[model samples]
Target: MKFTKLTSSVLAGATLLSIMAPTASFAATSKAGSADAKTNDNGGTKLPQNDHTEVGISFGDNNSNGNTGYLRLQAVPHTLDFGNHKLLDDSKLDFTADGKNTSLSVNNTKGSFNGTNANQTTTLATGTDTALDTVKGTAWATVVDKQVTRIDPMNGPEDTSDPTNPKPTSGFHKGTDSVAGTWTLSVQATSPLTAVDNGDPSKEIVDENGAKEEIKDAKLTFSDTQYAQTQNVLGLTKDKNDNTYAKDLADLTKQPTVAPVKEITKNVSTPLVANGSDITVAKAAAGEGQGANVFGWLPENIKLTMPAGAAVSNAIYKANLTWTLNSTVA
Candidate 1:
């Protein structure tokens, strides 16, 4: 499940107008003389007028003047469906799978244009079980979530969202400031894989002879692999001595990586930090647009090792994974 909320405040600022001076008019009349008589008279003064009385602008949390800033994160592959695993008995059995097989992604949006922290730290927490399991179903393993060490983002050349480009999504401009800052994300699985028998109506695990059983001796571990597009693409380049200038979004060296795989157990918190990742996910210059999507694929490696004396249930197994992305930086 996902939840989100944002707080916005309009920093109404004062607008100043320099007052202008009043205009004056005068006419002079001189007494009649023999040949060179003249007359002059003076009229009062007229005050200057202004059309506007108030001058104010709105701003956000960052160095924004009459602009807005925001941070957003969304889970990719909303559901991690590890499909179809066969049952094994007595001897230990194992199954290994990848996250990419399920199509995983984490979409993020950060900007200092309106807020100061263009960079955010993301963390994951395990949550509830799925509908396929009983209310008090026992988890198959002590640990469930794991990740590899942080890896560079697949910093392919800036794309024009062209179908011909590898992993194409969007493009970066030459003058706009790409989203600058480092952000990290973590993934978590709250429950264990439970096998529901094909004959049982409650979706409970069953023995060969047909007795309900809970396979608590099974261990499920998670892993990940990071990849980048390496074909004909446009990349952002920068001067090594200068930080303020870049050729385009592809010019920046934003990269993301998967940290070493972690072993997740029930009730034990396994925190996966983005150790060496950068903004290669997507690049944005100021005012290019809102929420430019930087798309990348994550291949998850899942291994299920069953202990000896495990039940032999010939049915499909299922589990729930909760991927949480936090903005709290440590």
Candidate 2:
């Protein structure tokens, strides 16, 4: 019985050894596979759809977008006062004394005065010292003349503290989107200079033959005319030696600036007849008169020539002058 039991135990131990041998072989294979394992890495990339953006612009006082881009008449002379003239019996009513008439003065009823003599009032005849006393006669008919694309109204309280840098109560600004183009300025006499009856202000003075007393063959003349730009791009300025020169405000290396050196039309001695056609005083070609420009006329140069023997009268005579500005040059 003991021999048989020993044989069975030996067989059992052999079976257990076979099972443990297989388990050990599987563990050894797993460790070898882990030590020789390989790994992989991945990468990704992206691109932008667009790289830029755009902006828009426009001009004028029509919109509330704060864009100012339109041609405008900034200022003009409202009154060209030829002071009271004493009607002499034998003297011809001529103010054209080779542009030396001391009786002529321009009263700027419109726009700001930028003249060196702003408060100067000329007293043609002897009189009391009044505001009108400073109405001094000048050889030049100076007006606050400006032609611009845009202008700004007085924004806040004016600073009158400094005289040299007198803060302009009003100013003009160049439009960001302004288109450079041509322009024109013209003048016309709407009415004839007729004498008003002494007895009646409404009625005209008539002669013995019932003819209306009028200054016949009278001509308005302008001489030594010049135009200046606020930006100083183009204008006529005099040197210290009284020699006039065309001021070029562009770089010397670039093309010359376009401007007028003389009057557009020679309406010098020609009569500006009543109800006559429009006469061009000044003009600007394409790419010329841009930004704020001023027109200066020698006051003495602006004269009225009256022919002799135009019927005697002790009455006041009056006439009307109409100035027109057009965006497109004619």
Best by TM-score: 2
Tell me the TM-score of model 1: 0.30
**Candidate 1 lDDT over residue span 1-330, tens digit each:** 122222212212211122343556874432232223231221222223236688877321112122112322322333223333323434425443321112111211112111223311111211232221221111111111111111234435655666676463333222222332223334454444555655552375656898644455455454332222111111111112112222332343553232321211212222212221221222222222122122222212444455666555545455444443333223
Lowest lDDT block of 10, candidate 1: 140-149
Q: How good is model 2 by TM-score? A: 0.44
Q: Indicate the residue-level lDDT of 203 in model 2.
A: 76
**For model 1, what is the error of residue 55's alpha carbon versus the real structure, in angstroms, after optimal superposition?**
53
Each candidate: what lDDT? 0.30, 0.45
RMSD of 2: 31.7
Clashing pairs in 2: 60-69, 120-134, 121-134, 121-135, 121-136, 122-134, 122-135, 122-136, 140-299, 141-299
TM-score, every prediction: 0.30, 0.44
lDDT score of residue 69 within candidate 2: 28
lDDT of 2 by residue, 1-330 (tens): 999999999999999988888543332234333444341111121221247777866321111222122444443444443434434333545553222233432322212111222222221221232322222232221111223322245546678899779785544343222233466777777767777765564677777999876766666666655554433211211112111112322322344344432335534334645786687776765566554445545455567666666664546665666766666632
